[model samples]
Target: MNEESRTNIGTPVPDASNPEEVREQVERTRDELGRTVEALAAKADVKAQAKEKTAAAKEQASEKAALMADQLRAKAEQATQLVKDKTPDPVLEKTAQAAAHVRETATRAGQYAAERAPDPLLENAGKAASFARANRNQLLAGGALLAAFLLVRRGRGRR
Candidate 1:
């Protein structure tokens, strides 16, 4: 509301007979039309709008990734703290020693079993293994058939 433009706001249209006034009016109309076109053009800028949407999506993804990373870190820290609290150094050492003992025992038992097998028994086992390998598909199908028959027989027995 400047005093000057305020007066122009209510100014009546000049007579069409005046060439200069008509020209000025047309120029003003052209300026207003250009401004309207510019506004519409800005609104209709699909590439810019798409870029804005993509940036927003990327920002959201980054925020989510950061949040997930923070949660994972917190969970890992909590798990570490819980493990530290529940298992003292002596307990951990004993657990490790127990695991090693079990592993060693299993290895010794396997070795003993292998050593105690008779030559005939080992040879028979090897021949069976070779045969099974050569007829893997047939063996699998036969095993499946046997399993199905057993299941059916058991079901009948139950009734």
Candidate 2:
């Protein structure tokens, strides 16, 4: 084709002089149109847009939950410190002694149970104890928080 007749890059103009060239151009235009239609249809799809929004919301919610968990852990530590500060040293020592006695009793009971309990029960108890040991810090913090809350409530009632 002459440079004068050509337009938009090397794309040929549809003319009667070359039927084959016109056919090729028509096919190319149809392919381009089909792709454009598909892009528009995808943009118009409600379900796909909804799914994208839901994924973004879930990611945001997960981030917020992680942040909240960290804050809660910090607060638990502070509550535990406050409890330790308020308690008398003699009371603390007595509490520790009582805890040791309880531990000794538990050890003897566990030994007796090991001798007579079924294998499945012992296995489950072992798993529970393992989990408790692994999460001892968290457990202690929780217990301290509960104790602080109860003390606050009792003090308020006395007033």
Candidate 3:
């Protein structure tokens, strides 16, 4: 409200006395209004805003992951200490023996299975190739449809 502070730094308010001045002012205002609308629209874009939020979330998650690991390590240490303090010597010995037995059994079984199933990956791949060859027409049709759908969506996105 102070006269000393008042200055015409922006577009002036239209005075209706001059018709040409009013029209010029109206046009200027429309241009400004259009720009304002465009800026607002850009700000309100949900996908862009979501992407910004997702990036912020990913950054925070990466920062928190280190903290989470430290917390888990602390918890694991506490659990181990508690177990050592509470468990009986006899029970611990039995548990260790049981774990050893399980490991031995698993190792022997794995060796037996591996002996029986040599070249598993190659065999499975051969079977897969045979199945695909048998169903080539259906697979090709499905692939073409998927490709067309993706291409159409990509075209629409570019527009």
Candidate 4:
């Protein structure tokens, strides 16, 4: 081989006057561009896989949260029903009846004390009855006033 030909052996030598060589070069460039596009497509596929994993994680978290909310709602409903079912209604009624009986007995004792005593003993008894009546009225009025004050304070606090 001649020295110049040997030096140019592997170098691209476009035949500027030949349309076929230009077409061949264009075809080779197109193949290289296709390889670059394929590499970019591979990178895009990896990014899409990451996005899909993130979306799946979000969907799973949302499903778990909804399931937890449903369980909490069911437990709250069960607790409310249990409270309603367990109340002691018969015991409350008996307690009310016993309180009424005690009131009646006290009234009878007061009436008997007024009726059976002598005049001198009756005067002392009358004074005691008057004091008892005044004390009862004061206690009732104080209790009512305290209840009203507490109710008013509670109402204001809620607001």
CA lDDT of each prediction against the hidden true structure: 0.71, 0.80, 0.70, 0.70
How do the candidates rank by TM-score, highest first?
2, 3, 1, 4
TM-score of each: 0.40, 0.63, 0.40, 0.31
Candidate 4 lDDT tens digits, 12-120: 7677799899899879879988999999897889888899899999999999999999998788666545533553455335445655686799789868976886689
> Per-residue CA lDDT of candidate 3, range 1-159, in tens?
664346344766566689999899889889999999999998989999999999999999998999999998788666556655565565556555655686699668757765677697647855876897786545543443444456568879999
Q: Arrange candidates by lDDT, highest first: which order?
A: 2, 1, 3, 4
All predictions: root-mean-square deviation over Cα?
A: 17.2, 6.7, 23.1, 24.0
Off by over 4 Å in 2: 1-39, 138-159
Overlapping backbone residue pairs in candidate 2 total: 0
Tens digit of per-residue lDDT, candidate 2, span 110-140: 9999999999999999999899888876665
Using alpha carbons, what is the TM-score of model 3?
0.40
Could you say which candidate leads in TM-score?
A: 2
The list of candidate 4 runs beyond 4 A from truth reads 1-44, 90-159
Residue 56, model 1, lDDT: 100
Per-residue C-alpha lDDT of model 1 across residues 45-87, encoded as one tens digit per residue:
9999899999999999999999999998788666555654655
Worst 10 residues of 3 by lDDT: 139-148
Which wins on TM-score, candidate 1 or candidate 3? 3
- Among these predictions, the greatest lDDT belongs to 2
